[model samples]
Target chain A: MNLFIASLAFSVVTAATLSLAAVAFSLQFAVSNIFNLAFGAALTLSCYAAYFFFSIVGIEFWLAIGLAVLFSGLFAAGMSAFLVGPFIRRGASAFVLMIVTFSLGTIIDYGLDGGFRDNSFTLPFGGSSLAIHAGPFELSGAQLVVVALAVVMTAGLAALLHRTRLGIAIRAIVDNRMLAGASGVPTRKVTTVAWFVTGLVTGIAGLALAASTSTVNGAIGDNYLLLIIPAAMLGGLGSIWGAIAGSLVISLADNLWGVFVGTQYEVLIGLLVLMVVIMIRPGGLAGVISRGWGGT
Target chain B: MAYYISTLLVLFVSYAILGLGLNVQYGLGGVLNFGYYLFFAIGAYVGGITALGSDKGRVPALFQEIYAWNLPVHLPYPLTVLSAVVVAGVFSVGVGLIVLRSVRDDFGALMTFVVFLTMFTLIGAYANLFNGYIGISGVPSPVSNPELWYPILALGWLAISWLLVGAVTRSPYGRVLKSIRERPDAAAALGKNVRHYRLSVFILGNCMAALSGALLIGFIGAWSPLSWQEAETLVVFSIVIVGGRGNNLGVVLGAAVVGVGINEAVVFLPAVSSDPGLIPSVQWVLIGIITIGFLWVRPRGLLPERKAKWPWIDSKPGEVSEGNLLRKLRKGEARK
Candidate 1:
């Protein structure tokens, strides 16, 4: 019972961290129709930014987080505008976009390696995470913060999409770009903003994930990629709420598998669950857009 | 200097073989095979294990930490290489069974990446299965003399595989594979067995991949997980993409450029800044940029699959010309 509760506590923390990134990743696909394999690099890039500020410059943690988010968002927006935008303009398809993103990822990840020399760094909090004891389970201060942030972010995003004009425009762009463009939606500008916002969320997720893992490196994001994909796949490709639910299911499955089986098979178990889920649902948990093979 | 040049030539040839295999699978068949190194590893390990006389070479050193195996069986080199090719080919059949069901290109790539990583996890984590990361060593080479053997093997294997590739590409069988690659649904509508062709090409390409691995192991006299890095697949595939797809000579040319230019350029540089990563990181950054640049701007590659051919034949020039091209130049081939 105790072991089960501890695993549950841990999984909630994991789910909380993953939901932010998963939803952001789903959003990128939704608007741009890109797989954005480089999103992994964004995660690493933000994590390193946080590490640099928190560990090297020794700033307030929250301030460092803010800096990282702004930097990531700006970088992503700039990338979309300057680098990726031209190719798409030249009539690149999703498949070509996937490769393009892959290239960007390689450049960013390895470019950092050359600059930073491949050494692993940790987020330098002066002290450890505050311990909290409740019933049979124990948790950390950061863990609870993770849960709160996830709830707040999900709720905030839901409200934004539901209530705001910009959110409606973003959705319009996703559904039918031509129709949206015909209806006086600023499709290109809206897209840039959407990219910026998703980039910020991705950065936050990266920061949270780095904290959860307790180490940061260029390679760290690549491994996180395995986890992020299942989360995004579990949640439908484009739905925001679906991402949160998917994160919970995947994280819960991963922790339980660790408890019941061995940790070695944890990743495999998550993947298998995703495979089964995707096979049955096909549209994902709350699929807004149904995907067909070999289609635009 | 001779040794260095020979070693470089040998590696270039091996990578050329890899490029050729990828050219078939990706170029002609339209199957995205990102985890190609796994097949190479399968061939290397199978060949090494076959030629390796005793587990005695590994057990004492390996068991010092983890698991041990007791064995004694060494096959002849010819049989060993053949077994390697056959085993890897057969293994790919099993892989194709599952992967071909979904035609989503990115999904296929992702699944292969998963399989690639899983292979490492299994080999690295399980001490008993692959001796757990210490790797296998001291497999017997095919010939006693390195001088004659290497030069012959390098040129001989490249020529042989190039010829075989050429033959397959020019056949009517090859014609249908390209049709499937261009339009699977349309090709199927025309009564072509698209799935079967894809799988056959996949299996055939892997057979060549295995053969290369076998020869590579023979040259090095060792086999290990280290030899087949996942990135190696992408690098080799990038060569195919950079070389003109559907052209064997172009693939070999691309391999030589990347093999010597980007990969082996490290040999010349003075060690800078005591940081071992500086060179490799720069190299990867360059590779990533170059691949993307070519893919984005010049998708057809440096030497685009040539359309010009012998004036006598009036078929489309690029569809494997039959003006007595060696290997693929069989007389009486069906013309459109």
Candidate 2:
């Protein structure tokens, strides 16, 4: 029972970090309708960028993180504006777009692998010893920060989506690009802004994940996709709240499996959950919810 | 020099077979199997295990202790390869049935990729299955003079694969498969069983991949988790894309050019740095660029698929093939 409670607490932290990336992924898909298979690579790029800024350039940790997040946002925006946008404009099929993003991911992943020329790098978080015990949960300072950041970001995003014109434009584009364009929403510009926002979230999520893990590698983000994709898909590909809910469920399931079964098979269990969920309800949890509420 | 040539030949044949399988799945049936290498890995593992025999004493003591399960008997080379094909085929059927149920083609592709990653994690974690990261090695080669006979054996297998793929792609059934690839709804409306055709192609393609793996293990004498990373599947995709998506002969050309040619070319480059990983990383980056560049510049590939025409229909003016539109315009036929 004690172990289970600890696991539950750990899962909440994990879910908080996971939800950021899942929502970002969902938002990207929502706006572009492309799966953005390179998303994991983008996350990895942020980690590497932070590493570069902190270690190589002698920047402070917090400042380095800010710069990394900025760089990642721009990189993602550039990818949308230059690489994916042109292909999409040329009317590439979904399969072709998948290949394009996958190939782009390969370039980034291998580029990092070659440039780094090391198996793994350690980030100097220097806060592993700082732990906080809240009820049954024991979490590091970084983990607590991650959880708090998630809460603040989620609330901020809600406000932005509900209160701002840009957010409204993004929502319109997601709902219907053609219709949004017809309504003079400047669909392309709004979509790019949406990509940038998602990229910022992805950067923070990657940094949080790196801080928690302490060790970073080229494949770190790629491996995290094992969790991110399932969470995003389970939440319904385009629903923000669905993504958050899905992340919680997946994280709980993963932590529970690690506690009961072996930690080694946690990833496998997550994937199995995705497969079963996809098989049973192709539209995901959001689909069920929507249908229940008399939505098409 | 002779040995190097033989190795390259075997590799070329192996890649050719893999390319053909992917061409069948993605090109003919429009099933994007991102986990194509999983079937190949399965074949290699099964083939290696079956040939390794039940004698624990034959292998290193570490492997003996690490491997949870062992085949009870040592099968002959033919039977080992056959077992690989059969096992991979069965596994593909299971995966295909589940994955093909997704309404979206891209979703199915992503599921296949997820399946690959899941299996990769499973194999790496479960050391008992294939001895973990150390992988299975030390299977005796069937050929006494491998240098002389292995290439010949590989060529024989390639010949069989070629004939098989050729027969399937050239027949009337192949036309239906093509129709499904172009327009699944239209094919369904025409009374063709789209799902059945897809599943069949999926199984057939996966079996070929397995056969290639079996053939490869016989030459390399080892198989491991490190051998079939997710990116390796992209290499086969590159072969199919660079050669020609729907063209079998073009796939062979692609295997030679992209698989063997680029690989050998890298071997000759002067080492720029002491880092052992640099060349391979750069090579992969190059391949990714080439794939994207080709997709953008020449989507049809070096040798595009020939337009199939009905022999009974009389020739009609101004009915130019898609690929020959430029030529038709150059010839001033559009004015008529």
TM-scores of chain A, one for each prediction: 0.93, 0.94
State the DockQ, from 0 to 1, for candidate 1.
Answer: 0.50
lDDT of 2 at B139: 75
Interface RMSD per candidate: 2.4, 3.8
Docking quality tier of model 2: medium
Candidate 2 TM-score, true structure as reference: 0.94
lDDT of 1 by residue, B241-323 (tens): 68877788889989888756678886567778688778887887888888888887798787787652445754564566554
How well does candidate 1 match the true structure, expressed as C-alpha RMSD? 5.2
Q: What tens-digit string does per-residue lDDT give for candidate 2 at B1-336? A: 889988999999999999999999998888998899999999998888888876767666666666565666689889999999999999999999988877667778888888888898888778888877779899767799998899999999999999999999989889899999998989999999999999999999999999999999989998889888878887898999999899999999999999998888887777766788988888889889989989999988888988876654434555656535555666887566
What is the CAPRI rating of model 1's predicted complex?
medium
RMSD of each: 5.2, 3.7
For candidate 1, list the clashing residue pairs, or say none. Answer: none
| lDDT, model 1, position B1 | 82
